[model samples]
Structure formats: C-alpha cells, structure tokens
Target chain A: MRLGPALGWFSRNYNYEVETQAPLQKHSVGSQQRTPIMYASLFEQKVVPVKHSTKFRDESVMKSKRISKFLWVGALGSVVVVSGLAEKVYPGKVAPSSPAQTTNSASTTGTSGYNVTSSTLAPPPASATAPSGLSATSGSSSSGSAAAAAPTAGS
Target chain B: MRQVLFRQDTLGTSCFLTSRVEGVDFERRFIAACETFSERLFELDQVASRFRQDSEVMRLSAENTGEPVSVSELLFDLVEAAMRAATITGGYLDPTVGNSMVGLGYSKDFELVRRDSADGMHFRVVLPSGYRTLVLDRVTRSISVPPGTILDLGATAKAFVADRICAELEHLYSLTCLVNLGGDISCSYVGQEVPWMVNLTSDGSLDPTSDGMLFGIAGGGLATSSVRSRNWLAGGTPHHHIIDPTSGESAVVDFESITVLAGSALDANIASCGAMAMGHRGIIWLRGTGLPAVVKRTNRTQMDGIARPWNGSELEFIGDWPEELVQLSGGVAC
Candidate 1:
C-alpha cells in the first residue's frame, strides 16, 4: 500500500472526493422535521429527483443524494478542524472570522475566574435602606449617649 | 361476662357481681343500684353518714332522750328482719345488742376508730346497743329506746344487697346473673338448659391440695357464714362480730363454717348469719329450715344434705363437676 501511494498514476486522493455529479440532495419536509439543524447543509446541496415514477425510485434517489450530502458536510467539518490547527501554528492568519470569532471571544471572556477584578459593576449607594425600629445616632462604636438611647428603646 | 367489683374499705366489705347480656349502657344501672343501697345501709359510720340520717334504728337512738321515735318503712323492714332472725335463732343472733357492741368499742365506724391506746391493743370497736330498754308500737311504726344506742348492719346489709342486686339484674338483663356480696352469693338462672355451677367449700379460703370443697349445680342463691372470717379479741375475750341477742355477746359456735343452700341466696345468707350468731345450736336450727345445708364443724367434722331442689351436699373437691344435685325419688325433707 505504501509503494502504490508512491506511484503517481496509481495514486488515490487521501482527502474525500465527493460525488458532486449525483442528484442534488433535495430534502423532503419529513427529513427536515427529523433533524432540523442538519437540514441547513441539505438546503445548500440542492439535490433533485431522478424520476417521477413510483415511490421506490424516488426514495432511492433521495437516499443516494442524502448520503452524498452528509459526506460532503463531514469533509467540510474536517477542513475546519485542520484549519483550526493551522491557525494555532500560524496565529491570526489561519483563523475563521466573524461567526466563529464571536463564539470564541464570548467563551474566553466568560471564564475570568477572579472576584478581585471587576469587569463591570455599579457603585454602592450613598445611603443604605433605613433600619425600621431604630436609627444609629453615630458610628458603629457609638460616639455618644444618643446612640445608646436610640438602640435602647428596642431592647 | 362483665363484672364491676366495688370495694369500700370504709365498710370493710366487698360487693362483687357478674353481669351478662347487658346492653351498651349498663354502667348507669349498676351505679344506680349501688347508690340506692348505700343510702339505706351507711349509718354505722360516726362521720356524717347517710345511714345516721336515714335509718329508723338511728331515729330510735336519737329519740332515746326525749320521746320514742316511730320507724320509717325502710327502717321498719330492716328491724323486723333483725327481729325475725333473733326469734328463729332463739336469740343466738340479735340486732338488739347495740349497747354491748358500743361498749366493746365498735361504736364509731370500724375504719374510723383509732387503735392508738394500749388498753385497746387487742380489742376492736363495735357500736353499743340499748336493746332491752325499748318500747315499740308496731301499728304506728314508732319505737322508744334509751340513749347511747349505735346500730351496726355489717351482717345483714351484704345479704340484702345480694337479694336486691339479683332482683335488679333480673329486670335489667334477661339473663342468668349472680352477685356475690363479700362471698354471700345470690344467683338467678333465667333459662333451664343446664344448671349453674357454684363452688361450695368449708371456707372460700381454699388450699389447692386438699379436697376441702364441693361443686353445687343448683339454680338458686347460696350463702356461707363463718366466724373464721371476722374475729377479734375484746377485754381479753376472743369475740366475733356475730352477736347473740339472748346473751348480748359474741356467739360461741363450735362450727368453723356453716353454709345454707336455699331457694334464694338471700335466704341462705340470712340463715347462715343467724346460725353463726346462734353459737352451738346453729346446725340444729339450720336443719330445721328444710333447706340443703352443709356444716363444717370446728372439730373437722362435716355434714351434707339436699333438703330442697336448690340444696346439695358439702363439696369434696375444688374442681368443676358436671352433675347436678337431683332430688331423690322419695321426697327428701330436712
């Protein structure tokens, strides 16, 4: 198998060679309902039916187009994974922009993991909510007899 | 079977009876019976007692200073019964010995009299009676008596209660029932499929080993009176509560115990108490009653006979016997 790979005429592409000549992977309303997330790639495939005969022929065509469409999507995902690795080696030049950039940026900003550093917060109010039963006449240590009198009423 | 036993230590007597087939609300009936009887018989107490206010004997005692007092129907009935007992026993048992009882120190309630003094260390107190000094008017229900007369009915009240309870239970529950007022037992059998079983022993204080008991399968009341139960010493003399009206003293009977089987346990109880009060001649007097009787003499001798349908032989065992005392062919007499 190694020698076969070395010869140019006998070489086969290691990357996926998708069959684009097959019918456009047109999705039925039932298939779209099954997995709504995967249907976006199916809409991009644009598959068409081979014949308008019985349901058997139409189903085979639909099945064949759906399988190829899935293979194409998997191949595209592999490319994205390889590109991510390449970006890690080459920095910002290999990175995908916009939608992927927003997701990556949002995740990194979430895990700051430090309570000391305030990203964004409001300042404390000038005065706190009033104590219902009594008013502190002075500081926490009680500056005068008025503070004692004000709290003594509660006791 | 349901039973409610009432024990008043003040009276020194036990009132116990068995009830069957009473409906859900039988407590009211039972308590009513107790209250009615207590009202009639509680006079012997020195404390403010119902008997002092209700008894004709007490009324007679009260009027001893001034004019003689006439008796009420309730008091008359009790006194007449006492008189009859005295007459039948030939003064062996007498209710008229009130002064003698009081002199012996039984004047107050038996429970209330304190025995702290050394002089009365061995003697128990009974009320004294002024028996001989009484003028009677039978038609007017009045009696005049001397002062210091204290009447005690510890003997007859139990038997009367047994009879009264039987009558009450018969009317309340249409079933065979028995009331044992301190072992003077009275029973009434409503139906006749089988005879009721009663244990007849020389004394109810039984020992498991000895054949000192008999089973009576009669359908009436039975009572046993014995000096073996209530005995005390007074003035260095061994005296019992069973008094002889003739002598105005405690009875001196030879028998350890005497049981009479009659048509009613009331009859048996009265006869037995009277006989015990009769001293030595109690057996002979009981024999004249024409009822079945068994007497266990103080000398360990015993006599048994079935003089009536309700009477039977003295028991020889403490166990149950299925056989009833059937009357023999030639009609038996006392």
Candidate 2:
C-alpha cells in the first residue's frame, strides 16, 4: 500500500498494510495484519483506492499481533500498580475509637519484651483515680476562667 | 487500682507516663519502659524535630529540591502520621507549619523566640495549609516536599510518640501503662476494676494540664490543647503557636483550650489540635469523632462533647455542652 502523511493514523492505530507483496507470494492467511472489520465482504473494498489481493492480508495479522501485545503490557502494568497500593504503609482501619481497644489481638500476642496482665479488677471507688483519666480530685485552682465556667460531666 | 507516676523531660516538654501494679518488679519494669520511652522520644526528636537545625527534619527541609529524599524510618512514619492528622482535621491541623512558625518568630525554641507583638506586622506564611503537598513513599521510606513548604510534625508525631510508648509498654511488659508527652497521654490496661484516675482542675488549666484531680480512664488516651501557654508578642499584639492555616494567623479566637479523650494519644491530640484550631465550632468536629471532650473558650464558657461524670463541686461541668458556643482551645498542648 502506498503510504504518506495520511497514513500517520495507521501507524498509531496498529493498522499496517503490507506495502510490498511479491506477485503470487503464496502468503498464508495468518500472515496478514488484522483490522477490526477484517471479515467484511470483499466487495466492500471495491470503491477504495488500493487493490485488495486475497493473499496479501499480512497487514491485518500484524495489527492483531500489535493489539494483543499492548493489552498484555497494560495488564502487567495494572498488576504492578495494585501491588504498590497494597504495600502502602497506611494504618487505615478501625482507628482505636471505641472504648474497647485491643490493637488487633492476633497481631498483638505480647510476644515482645512487654509482659501481659493477668489480673482482674474490682470496680473503682468513687474517690479513686480511674484509668480513663477521669476523677474527682482535691486540687487548688489557678485558672479561674476555666474552672468558674467549667461544666460538670454526667452520663 | 494501684498507680505509679513517672515524669521526665523530652521532645520540648515534660514527659509523663503512668503504670499500674503492686509487686516490686512492677516499678523496675515500669522504669525500664520509661527509659525506653525517653530513648524513643529522643530518637524521634533527632529525626523529626524542625527546631533543631541538625535534625533530619531540617536536613530534609534544606535538601528539598522537588526530589524524593531517603529518610530515616522514624521520619518517614512521622510524616505519614502527620498527614493522617492533616486529613482528619481537614487541613486545619497541619504538620507543614514550620515555615509559618518561622514567619511568626518561632524559628527558635519557644523560650528563645522573641515576642515583639504581632501588631502592625506584615508577613506571608508559605503554604500555611500545605501538608497535602508532602509526598511519602512508604515502600522506599522516602519523602519529598513542595518547594518553599515547611514540614513540621509537631502534634501528629508527638501524639504518636505517646501512643507508641504505651504500645511498647503493652508489648513487652503488658503492664497497664499510660505515656504522656507533655499533656498528651496514652494508656493500656488489660483488665482492672478500678480505672486510672486523671484529675483536672475546674479551670481546665491543671487536669493533665498538670497532675491534679482524677479523671477515670480504663484505657486509651487523653490530651489538652491550649493557646494560653504558647503566647508570644508579634508587633505589639499577642501571638500564639496555633495558626489557622486559612488565615495564616494565630487561632486565638477559636478557643482558649480543649481537652479530649480518645483511643490513643494520637487521636486525642490530633482531635484536640484540630478542635482548638477550628475555634468553638470545633465542638461539632470533636463530637463527630464521638470521643469525650471538654472545651474552654476565651469567654470562660465550658462545653462538653461527650458524657462524663462531673460529680465534684470543685470540678465544675456545664449541663449539655452547646455545639455553637464559640469553643476555643482549652490549652494548646501538642
């Protein structure tokens, strides 16, 4: 097929027409480049500029090969992208929000140098300091504004 | 429950971590954990602190050529945590405030900084809300920042340090523990009848703000953020450390102080910082997290974000804290 500036689109679209085909080359059908409409009726090309030799469909085969290769590379690239995201170090999950937090019990086996507690507790006394950092304390005041207008907590 | 208190100074403020136990070995192990905690804080400080020119944070800042720079694992994780806070706060609590701090004469330590008042002073803070510009590669443990942006991991990193210390205690000794970096506090307890008592003054000034009245906590963390502490004079006007990224100015009007209890020191501090910066409307922000909190405003109004028993007369509590009372920072403790 004769090619020119108009053929630039052909290169990008993986549509290559076998420009030089020896006469009676005996080319196999598999050697042709494939277009999306390769199976169209031969009569459809009668109005086109180029001659359509039944044996010179090598361009159509070439296009199919190129298209498949592009797809494989894209699949490989997508896998790499996903793997990268999976390995991201974001600690995204249920943030220790609820009153009960265990830091994923399975992940925390107390296998590290820390010792695990085995003791049970009795409910805290009214005057005792609770672990939640709440309590009725006996301390003098320094910040009047904060204390004077301070609101009591009740639940 | 039995209680033990440990205090030290590191990371630009006082460090407090609590442990509960009875036996003799408990003190020994608790002290050991404290030592490890102090070491970790120093290690992180050496890596993530912007005030120290020799810190990795400064090195990264100096070397930011719009290219990714390999950093210590600590710094890498620190930046990630700060980014998380920036995300949670909708950019109100930014870690990239180094340039903004410097713009306000906070280039040096707080004590070393000169307070000439902020009146009549014209200044521009680059990327006051630019924490999003930080590029972090967790796989490579590398980070990059936009040109002219400052990466300051003050609260996010500081709060995490507290959480990590408590986690470390839980990991090795499994000892009931609380790690407090300045006013940020974290605790871990497997099972106990009596909760840890953390006292707060009625004025909201001396709760974990100090070590006074008892607030009951079984686990998790607590923190207080206030602008009353880090005040400075900028051009004849008092300036503070907390800046509203949107305005590039101190967030003085938003709150006088805020105290929060959450699952970890990281959550507590990040939420409080964000709430403090949001001003009083931050109450809605804190309430959204469902964490228990108290906000003290400049007008001396107290608001509750969640439920807690305000039984003692000495420790006052306002009934049904309003969401729109112009809540401000109770105390700015990062």
Candidate 3:
C-alpha cells in the first residue's frame, strides 16, 4: 500500500510507446517517371524513420540532432511539394517529360475536387528527356506507342 | 500523312478536324474545311436553337397555334430527323423533353440557364409528355405540336449537324476526314489503313479530351453521353440534362459515360443518348445494335460481345468488344 505512490510516479515519468512502421519504400519507377516535379505524396510514402530510440541521450545533444534531422526532412519534403506544385501549376512550361500515367482516367471518372485545378486544355509540359510513365501496356499484351497519332480530338 | 486540327466552333462544343491525305496541303485544306464547317454549324444553330427565342424551333414551341404552318427546308429536315430518332430509340430519345429540361432549371441556353433558382424552384416529381403530341404534315411541308409541348430537337440536332458536315467536308475537300463536335464524331477515312483513334477524356466538360479509353473507328461515327457535367442541384437534389422520357426526369444511368460508334453520327448520337435515357437497359440495347462501343461506369468498363487482341497490335480493349463493327446484329431496328 505504501508503494502505490511510488508506482504512480514512475508511470507518469516514463513513456511507453508502440510504433507500427510501414515498410520504407522507394518511389516506384512508374511514380518517378512523372518528372519536372513529382508529387510530395510520392516521398511521403517513402518516408523512413531515419532514427528512433528509447535510450536517453544528453538533453542538449539529442535536441540538436533532432533539430538537424527535422530540418533536413522538412527542407527535402518542402522542395518536393513545391516542385510538384510548380510543375502542375505551370504544366505548359515543361514538355511532357513522360506521358504521366494518370491515377485514373480523368475523362471517364468525373474530375474530383482536388484534380480540377490540373485539368486544362494546355498540353502536357514538354520535357527534354522522355518522361517515364508511358509504359502502361509494356508488360500487358498491348504495345502503347508514344508517337501514335491520335486524331485531333476536342473537349 | 495524317494530321489533326482542333477548333471551338458552332454548337458551343469543341470541334476536332482529323485529316489523312497524301501528296499536298493537308493542313491548309483541313483548316479551310473547318472554316466552312463552322459557318454551316452556326447557320444550323440559328434555325434549330431552342435557346434562341427567335429561332424556328423555339418560335414553334412559344407559338404552338397548332395550325399547320409552312416550314423551312432546315426545319422540316430537322423535325423529320427528330421523329426518326425518337422512333429508333422507342421514345427513349424524346425531342419534346424541352419542357422537362426547363422544369429541371435548364430552360434557356446551358450557359444562360441558372444553376439554382432564387425562388428555390426545383423538381421532385414526374413531368408531362410532349413528343407524342407533335404532328408533322409532310404533304404540306408543315409541322405542329400540342399547345403545351416544348419541342427541343437537342436530342438529335447536333448529331445531324455533325453527320451533314462530315459528309460535306469529305466530298468537298476530297479527303478522308472526321468531324468531332465535343464527343459526337463522324468519320469517313476508310481507304487509309490506319483508323481514326479517339481517346475520350474529361477536363470538366461533358467530354474531356484527356484520358478515358481509346477507340479505333473507321468509316462510321462515334458519340459519348456522360452525366459528369452539365448538371446542377435542384431542391438540394442533383439534376442533369439527359432526361428520360418515361420518367419525365433526368435519367439515372448506371454508367458515367457511354460512347457509341455507329454507321452514322446520328445513329451513334441517338444510341449514346438513348443508352443514358434507358439507364442500365441502355447496354442491352447497345448489345442488340452490335455496334462497337465503350461504356464507363463509376467502377467498370464494358463493351459489346467479342474477343480481344483485335487487329495485331498488343492493345487489349477492356470490355467485351467485337473484332470489328457489325452492321446490325439483331439490334433495335432503326
């Protein structure tokens, strides 16, 4: 009965944590193919906990390392997000580095709220190198040609 | 060499001009053909536009005196075409659904039509009939509809324009060609081995020009009826332009978009709209027609009964598409 106060103090002072981690993954080659600016979500999925621990370190030292790591991740994430936005906002500026494989057929499925901003008559940004994503029919039986002449169709 | 041109022409829809001709001036000739094509579409709009109060069709709806009045060459042709469409579609593609359109808050031009009424006017009930009351006096070159009927030829007007102009352009320019008004595509480049390939996409309009599905068509026409856009909220309920004559309300089709390829743009347009108006039964009707088509629903893509890996290339048509377009396999007799 006398030990109850001591137990309560220990419980309040210590942190018990269980973390379920999704496996760290690299962006699929298909995902990376959409160049000029790739979506931030691509990297968000790849986020790996660079470091984790229960062992205590010098308070000042731990804080400094954490700050540096936080800054690094934040800066990289920001760059990815900003670049993706830039590529999308001004898609016409860049050549379609690759015929990006759309998440869904925009024409058949009505453009949802988030994608409305990217839907435009402006052609896909021009890319100097052949952008990746066009291999939709690569493994499949179909041969998807990049230079296939589509009839000049209108919206 | 194959060449393509895109233009925003008459009928308030984007027009695609596809040319495949060898030896010379394909680009110049294609542009000129589009110019002529656009002017003709404008003229047809003036004569057939129900949105224009002064147009012939609108005038008829506004002043249905019921007296057999002399009709113009265009009006008579349009009326005949409308009746034919209604007949082929078994009233599924009713031209007299104009009142239903107005009742659902699309009374005037689509752009001019208010999405929501200030008075909170809306529809939640079945509407009355209009097509059954129309009377055409072929002998006298006149037509009449019941007093209350609103004759909107929209169900088939644009298709007729596409069909007419496509044929005109091919013969006039002496080149293989295609005329795409939004999704209503009329093509006639049979001699060229390579068919006109169309991939329907939607940016926001009824038919977006981005990604959907690719259709390789030769000699015939294709049309798409998608319920994604040109819709609004009425009484907090969603309403669209495609109205079912039987229900007297906007159709409740299972598919998000239906694209049909028929012997003519008119037939393709009728089948596409009729499929939308018929709801799920539209697919059955299309199957009966045996025309090549692609229907994209919210979850699945389907086609007519046939096999895959058609015509050499590795491409596989997603649906049950046939190897080639059938003339009419036990289809709804048009």
Which candidate achieves the best TM-score against the true structure? 2
Q: What is the i-RMS of every prediction?
A: 55.2, 31.8, 22.5
lDDT score for residue A22 of model 3:
15
Superposed on the true chain A, the predicted chain A of model 2 yields a TM-score of: 0.19
DockQ of each: 0.00, 0.01, 0.02
What lDDT tens digits, residue by residue, belong to model 1 across residues B265-330?
545666777777766666666666655555655544344532221222333211121222222122
- Scored by CA lDDT, what does every candidate get? 0.41, 0.52, 0.53
TM-scores of all predicted structures: 0.51, 0.62, 0.61
Task: List where candidate 1 sits over 4 angstroms from the true fold.
Answer: A1-155, B1-10, B22-56, B109-139, B146-149, B172-176, B191-196, B200-219, B300-334
Alpha carbon lDDT at B314, candidate 2: 20
Best-first order by DockQ: 3, 2, 1
lDDT tens per residue, model 3, B199-280: 5453324232233344344456667777775677778677888898877788887776666656566677777788778987
lDDT of 1 by residue, A44-94 (tens): 111111122234534443565566568758967998888889888898777
